[model samples]
Target: MPVFSGIWVALVTPFNEGAIDFPALRRLARHLLDAGVSGLVACGTTGEAAALSKDEQLAVLDALLDEVPGDQLVMGVAGNNLTEVLAFQREVQRRPIAGVLVPAPYYIRPSQDGLLAWFGAIADASTVPVILYDIPYRTGVRLELDTLRQLARHPRVVAIKDCGGNPETTLALIADGELDVLTGEDGQIFNTLCMGGRGAIAASAHIHPQEFVRMADCIANGELAAARVIFQKLQPLIRLAFAEPNPAPVKSLLAMQGLIVDELRLPMQRSSPTLLQRLRAELA
Candidate 1:
């Protein structure tokens, strides 16, 4: 099985004066790794990969490769275009990476057969493990349970970042035990872990990563009471992180800590003053 276990931070890309901030990024990556997160996922939604140009994305990946261990890193690979996506994947896999987190083709909303072909081609082509990212809200296409089960048969398809929002399907995947099920929903992290799912690729975990890591470890060790306490403590911050468009509230909090500059590219604005006030109160 793939080593996609424990709390993995869905890292936020730090921006400074409209350029990627390598210094802040390197520091943040080190902080999370030191906090004992299972690993770091670069260029996922939380990292604003969609907002980055392909070259910029590759640059971010390269920076992470230098800062994070190859085996402890996963790069987000997403595109609706098969040929183009494949070419990009080739570039990413050129560097040693633990896995590639892929979602179903967005905007196109491919059928189950289409999804199977899409992921199969990538899995067939990938030298590293392929982690299916089932985020229908963003992709506009939910990866049906049957489709997921079939894809699990692929040798390189080792895990999933499940944001499918279907409890039955989530339960089914856990029961099937085919792929390592990592919840993409921060709130579901605790529930998923308790239900025997492996872990999470959490955007909110970017904040209190040590707590998230501790929660996973506690649960893994059968210390349910201890893990529950950490989960309850995190509930407020988790709720506030997505209170606005993601990475806004998250970046604001990180900036308050001086980890990164409080900046995001156009259209992805900073968190509202009211939201920031709320975050300050919570962090305080």
Candidate 2:
């Protein structure tokens, strides 16, 4: 398996006064890498990829490509909008990115067939491999298992970041034996692993990377008892991070650690006082 295996966190983009906070992002990226995360995903849903302008997105990617080690798998989010996506692919072709993370169109809610075509065109256009992102909760569209298997036939489409929240769907895909199923749901990693999935690309790994990576490694190495202990410890934190809109709770935790400003772009505000108190107590 590629080093892309194991926990890859969809990183939160830190900001201050409406500009990307490079210092904060650098600090958090360093923290995550030191904590044993397998890779870093910049500009994913949790990173608020949609809120960023094209240049801002590239700037963020360039900063990460510089700060994060070359060995780390640095994947950037490639949202829908075929024209812009194609442009992004060409633009980044010269950069030092490992792969692209993409999702089905959100507002348009394309049909399964439409999704297959949309991703197919991008995969054909991309110089790098594409990791299909399936988070129906965010996109309002789910790339069904059959459609996914069909897309897997394409050479440029490599792995999947699955947030479908259904192991049955994951199991079916594993049985197809084409694509690698990397769990996006933090709560489902163990079960997904037991069901023959490869690993996870979790948002929660942003805070507790070593523990999460340990749990996956334990299970992979067949140490169920140790894995269960770590999984139980992780549940509370995972629940809180996702208790609100993503990156909000996570950014708050990072802020408390003095990693970033904890400032989110408009439409995504800071966590409520209740959540902050709960998060501190949970961590304590």
Candidate 3:
């Protein structure tokens, strides 16, 4: 329920010399929780879910489960393979998670009908609530408004991590009020919340999660001016989080805190020296 309506950190999967670091991962989860993040999303794009093998992904989820309650965790499920994705979903259900964060099949562009069919199957099989991940930039396909509205009709499809970047669609979704609209884009968190969004699944919140939590709480309590101040302060870190690419920037800051090792899986690189300097200055 927290992930459905509050600031859930899109966690970075800690790695050590190219291997999954379970102990460090658990430590990071506890760190975020202690900072008051509403919940944690394991294996999201920020967590490099794509780079990890299925077994490793589940292992990461299990490790987090050891540190957080089921209601405070959401498992990210992604893959272009329908059968494999469904099977992974089944495996994920063996544990008690709040919901599954699923995006459209990546790389293979599917028509709206295809998108509908794809989500339909997943939603049908889902025992837990489904949070539709609509990040077209990464998934290479968009979940048009109509497709989302149709999916909203499903009892299981209860929310969306909205990073589609179409404001009109965002507004429509907010107005429709069927599903909880959680912005995945860090920069849009404030605007989206003001537009009646449920909350955010923010990657930048990984740095100062308590502030993000306070910001959301402020907005919810009708303290717009206070919320704006928090958002403004977080704006720099949010911009820098994506300045290079994803968890690299976020991971760099966390590493500086000695939370985890400064590492990332191949095909992804660690933050550059210059960016690290900027990160240090920003945190300073």
As for TM-score, the candidate ahead, 2 or 3, is 3
User: Candidate 3, overall lDDT?
Assistant: 0.93
Q: How many backbone clashes does candidate 2 have?
A: 0
Worst 10 residues of 2 by lDDT: 70-79
Supply the global lDDT for candidate 1. 0.93
- Sorted by lDDT, highest first, which candidate order results? 3, 1, 2
Ranking by TM-score: 1, 3, 2
Residue 84 local lDDT, model 3? 97
Q: Which residue segments of model 2 deviate by more than 4 Å?
A: none
What's the alpha carbon RMSD for model 1? 0.8
Displacement of residue 253 (Cα, Å) in model 3 is: 0.3
Q: What's the TM for model 1?
A: 0.98
The regions of model 1 sitting more than 4 angstroms off are none
Expressed as tens digits, the lDDT of each residue in 111-145 for candidate 1 is: 89999999999999999999999999999999999
TM-score of each: 0.98, 0.95, 0.98
In candidate 3 the C-alpha lDDT for residue 37 amounts to 83
